[model samples]
Target: MRDCCLLFQGGTQLPSSCLRDEDVVALFEGRLPVSVNVLAHHHAARCAACRTLLVTLAHGDALPSDSVPLALLPLEQGRRCSRRPSVPDATWTPPAVLDGFRLERLLGRGGMGAVYLAQDARGDRRVALKVCVALQPDERALASFATEARAIARIQHPNVVTMERVGEVDGRPYLVYEYVDGKSLAELRPPLPWPRVLDIAVGLAAGLRAAHQCGVLHRDLKPGNAILEPDGTVKLIDFGLATFVGSGGTAPRGVREVVGTPRYMAPEIRMGESATARSDLYALGLLVFELCTGRLPPVRRGACAAFKPEAGRGPAALLTEWLPGIDPGFAAVIACCLAEDPSERFAQADVLCAVLEHVRRLVAFQRTSRVFPTPWMGAGFPPPKDEGILAGHNVF
Candidate 1:
């Protein structure tokens, strides 16, 4: 019982303990030779006096340096006589899916969930995380919410914000989404350029087309839900209120005011009629109007109002100059979308996408004679030297 410590002391001697020299080496190897590792096996085999000394060394009250040649181990083992890394306080253990994602800040909150900005582990990429709270809702509402999550998970398009993963922790749902880097169209204070407006319109049309192809409809199509990513990409989000075109609360089938915001709501949606694909188109047209003119289409007192020439002047004027020879076509398309009769609008999102592509070609044709300055260059931005917009501004 006295042999263990004596065997380890001064680099060699049998101690008044039961642990053999071979047992001591085995314990050291088990700990990977880390300093101050508690000799559990040796203690279990030792007498009371030897056990007490081992306990003191394990607790760090007594140094094992004089008894053992631990200094020959790694620098870290020699420096700290501790069992584990020094953790000052208990920290919140993040969910497994969010292991290395550093939560930056809460972006916004809605009825279904909250959005947060976080850094992805791999490349430190910025991403948006939508975490759903298990709030007290009726069974029907909860089912609908889950359905929305599943529907969005099935969609894939460059213009639609991609759902990375869906995680459930403690009965709460969390959605990981690709981060869109630009401000919302509604948040764009001034009127946007015709080209930029068309760009967003084309992207939105493409995204909606994909959703429609899969038998889905974005009941709520508003500027607020569209974002321009930093890479000049557009993405549409907030599908929590969306539903299958003919299923759930989608118009022509259900009675609830299921999707869409008031300002951009189609006449059908507002009238308690079934929201159709055309209803989504109508909302998209309204968003286009907002982007081009920075004005909301006026709705009368408790009813859809007539397009008053005076009130619609801002957007109308911009459209006039921007459209030129192509203005009538654009106006006609928008008017058709906003028609009181859903049947009068474009039958499918693909048709709308084609129409928008044509508009882009028209813009390119119209700008052939004169060069329009880059939109970002208007506010004292450096112009392309090769493009000859500046003098001696060598950007290369």
Candidate 2:
């Protein structure tokens, strides 16, 4: 791979120079060093050969144009240049084989890449294959993809999605994840039962705790990123926006340039601050709110301003109004998770998990008591000989 940076003399026309095949492969496979990434971007802008190579690597076809979005361009001196390059008009076509995995069908596509439901020939198991789209092949996007693989690999928990392998085929980087046989929480219609919601919340929190223990911060946590298995197990998925705590810097900030979903983003994140474990907790709080009320917390967007909190009422009040029988403790936990100040929220995912577990038990006890009330013990009944139902139970 080329190690030298390409110097540009400022012109809109294509440059006379082109990238080497090795350098193009390295860039698409996310193997390029930071320095080469900047040079690759500059050269890709003017060299149709490099652009077509990237297109072929991403989609197995040539593109009509090679206009790169300004957002995808690397920031120079922490600032984005004003020039807009033409983005290539390309479409993705799933390849039959990637490495040893046989692609069964395209699962979905996102801003970063496309996912395929694939079969691992060697292991004889199905997996979700995520291939990085190479339309622009920006360094940041490649870095994010690599970060997700590293993050998921570090976390091994039943509630978190498992990564089997990561490899590049035909210059396209891809990830193999344990295929989940269920729908995302986003697909579940709201007005979900409180018990069911709490069950999912507990699992999600546990997963987050596991990730946090590994120093991986899942900056993006939303219903769409959580899957509900057939056995009621909730698995957190999509760590593309995840970052390590103290990993040097946060995402670049600008108008509509945040990395996470606006509705679930913490206040600090909305304010362009680096996301910490607490930020994940805040998103969990929002997920809980959405599950209970069938809607996200209200926010308003100005013409040029970021999203601002617009809910006139506290979460507890809104929750109580929506579900009158909701547990006060549960409501309080949600409130704490949504605290504007990171310090005010739950210190860790485990803390939130413990509280949610307790609330679950309380709800279970209440339901059981209602169903099987201790028959009004008569004077002779002697309080039913202390049935031991509440025995060994820790009073919350």
- Name the top TM-score candidate: 2
Question: Taking the tens digit of each residue's C-alpha lDDT, what string does model 1 give over 1-396?
Answer: 112322233333333333432233234224223322333443333333334434433432211112322222222312222121112122223343464567788786543456788888878688888765434333533554576677688788898888877766555656788887787665677467656777888888898888877667777677667887665677888776666754332444543342445456566554456667778887888788767666654433323332333433423343565555324445544554554556656767787787667656655665785654432233232321221122222211
lDDT of each: 0.55, 0.65
Please report, as a residue range, the 10-residue window in candidate 2 with the lowest summed lDDT.
381-390
What's the CA RMSD for each of the models?
27.0, 13.6
The TM-scores, one per candidate, come to: 0.61, 0.68
Among all candidates shown, the one with the greatest lDDT: 2
Off by over 4 Å in 1: 1-100, 121-124, 134-141, 246-252, 300-326, 369-396
For the record, the alpha-carbon RMSD of candidate 1 to the native fold, in angstroms, is 27.0
